[model samples]
Target: MRIRAVGTSALMIEVEDPLAWFAALDAARTDGRIDVTDIVPGARTVLLDGVPSVAALTAALRDWPPPAAASVTGDRLDIPVIFDGPDLAQVAAHVGRSPEGVVADLTGTAFRVAFGGFAPGFAYLTGLPWSIPRLESPRPRVPAGSVALAAEYAGIYPTASPGGWQLVGRTDAVLFDIDRTPPALLTPGRTVRFVIA
Candidate 1:
């Protein structure tokens, strides 16, 4: 991976692996010298957008050895969820496991807030069990605090917005509220762990 200057608008850190980019982002964000307003992390590249001189930031990133897997160790966010999703039975059938097993996998393991872009406060995570079912369609109004799953990840809907992720459960936590500072509770690169009560 190479950290190159991509004009004054942003500094592009070109990374080959998705995980490496996150590790680099985790490192750069810790250093206070470079003010990063936007850390757009992707599968290969992590883009930083800000007004500071790109030359200075680029230099700061150069020779920055990506951290080890353990260093990038994500956070655990315990999100309490219910197993009353409409697709609960179907998901269990798809994975050849009991509905209780599906519920356990979704809330028992640790996941990370890989990115936040699908919507305001909408977190995109990874490291979900692969034996889950795919979302067939979206619901017009998935109540707030709904814990949904799709593909290989799961997330909580910050608002009562239309979504496609398989309905899994709901949490009482406020993921995104404009009243709070910056309004967003989750940011990319942070870890998450779900704890069902």
Candidate 2:
């Protein structure tokens, strides 16, 4: 738990794991009186953006201790997915499981927002059992809402873009919409449970 001055109007909180950092940042949001514009969680740091000034923000964070953050509220979205991806067979073969089994295993689990990167609203969901191999090659164009898996994480393509993850299914969850207030279905530390429907 370290705070660094970010010019003016910003503070950066560094932590070992970004997911853990998210927990702390959300806590600060509830406990402090600072207006945060953005909280960008890195692998080992959290960038707290949009503040009044550096000196004031630094002083404000001094009172903050890394404690358990309140559970972030995430919309329980039901996305109907069609489990049809080219990598379906490959992923199952790597794990010595059938493709149907892979789908079943994937759908039954819930995930959290480890961080947000790779693409807008794309939660770098960790805790995907932690034994899967990282993607060898990224696809040129992964369709929007594509369900994918990688080492220790599973993700959904918020929008159609290039990505490097094992595709399993496609969801219709509107992860990002400009009209929406936050414009994302997943937020830091928010639980995400997937269903086969």
Candidate 3:
């Protein structure tokens, strides 16, 4: 792990394993070792905001170890989805499987939220045993609640926007709500299951 200064009050810790880095930070926070306002985790780094100084944070992290288990145990969310996406057949063909087979593969496996990016409430899920390719040409607009997959990640479109991920289904679950205490339904460390509707 490598720690670097980010501006005056933030420190960015670069790690080879982001999940482990997040777990360590979470452990530190739970143990009252961290004195920061926010921790933003990316695919490869974590940003600590509102820290007093990089030196202090670095010293604190020097003795911190990544937790053997995940510190954040989020609620399990089961989402019901209708297999009626425009790219469903295309995805199936690309994977050398029938549509039913593709759906079976998706529903048979459980996924975990690794991180959030691209859009608010857009969680890049991990644990997909198989990989899928992105579209050669991205769609101009993907409808809200679209369940899509690209590479090794699965995601739900929090809101309508342009996207390149292959859509395989649609879910009614609200991924984000401004009025909610935590706007994003799929937070990091949360486990997700997709049920065929």
Candidate 4:
């Protein structure tokens, strides 16, 4: 693991495996060892914001053991989706599979929330191995609950927004709500599953 300064009160911790690092951070937070205001995870980095001191954070992490393989110990959310997106056929053709085959492939695998970005409540989920390219021309606006894939990650649009991911389905799950204690339904390290409705 490598630690670097981020502006004034933030530290960026880069690790070979970000999920493991995030797991370790979660454990530390549960044990009341991490006092940072926010912990944001990326593909392979964790940004610790509002840190009291870099030394303190480093000291805690130094004694923390590396996390085991990706495990879904927390809540596993099941999202029911209807496979009727405009790009469903195109995605199936691009992947050399029928629409049913494409849906089967997606539902067969378990996904984990790797990180949240692009928008609020928008989680970048990992586990799907097949590569799906982004649209050459992005849509002016994609509706909320749109299930889409880009590169190697699958995502659900929390709200209507302009996007380029190839949509394969849509769900009715409320991914973000201001009144909720946690505004975003998906967080790093959470387990997720997509199912046909």
Question: Which lDDT values do the candidates have, in the order given?
Answer: 0.72, 0.75, 0.85, 0.87
Q: Would you estimate the TM-scores of all the predictions? A: 0.78, 0.82, 0.92, 0.92
* All candidates: CA RMSD (Å): 3.3, 2.7, 1.6, 1.7
- Model 1 over residues 24-126: C-alpha lDDT tens digits? 5656567864677777775457788873778777776675666555233535556666567777777778778898898777766767666676778888777
1 against 3, candidate with superior lDDT? 3
Q: Kindly list the per-residue Cα lDDT of model 4 for residues 1-197, writing each as its tens digit.
A: 77887887888988777877777776777788787777888988988888888787777776767677655657888999998999999999998999999999888878999999888899999987589999999999999999999999999999999999999999999999999968989877788889899
Which candidate number maximizes lDDT? Answer: 4
Question: Candidate 3, 61: how far from true, in Å?
Answer: 1.6
How well is each residue in 49-166 modelled by candidate 3, as lDDT tens digits? 9897678888888776654654445777889999998998998888899999989988887788888989889999888767899999999999999999999999999999999999
Provide the global lDDT of candidate 1 against the true structure: 0.72
Residue-wise C-alpha lDDT for candidate 2, range 1-197, written one tens digit per residue: 68887776777777656666566666567777666877777656788888767787778667766655435556644557788877889889988899998878777766667677777788877557535675777788999989888877888999899888888888888887778977877877777777775
Off by over 4 Å in 4: 59-65
Return whichever of 1 and 3 wins on TM-score.
3
Worst 10 residues of 3 by lDDT: 64-73
Model 4 local distance difference test score: 0.87
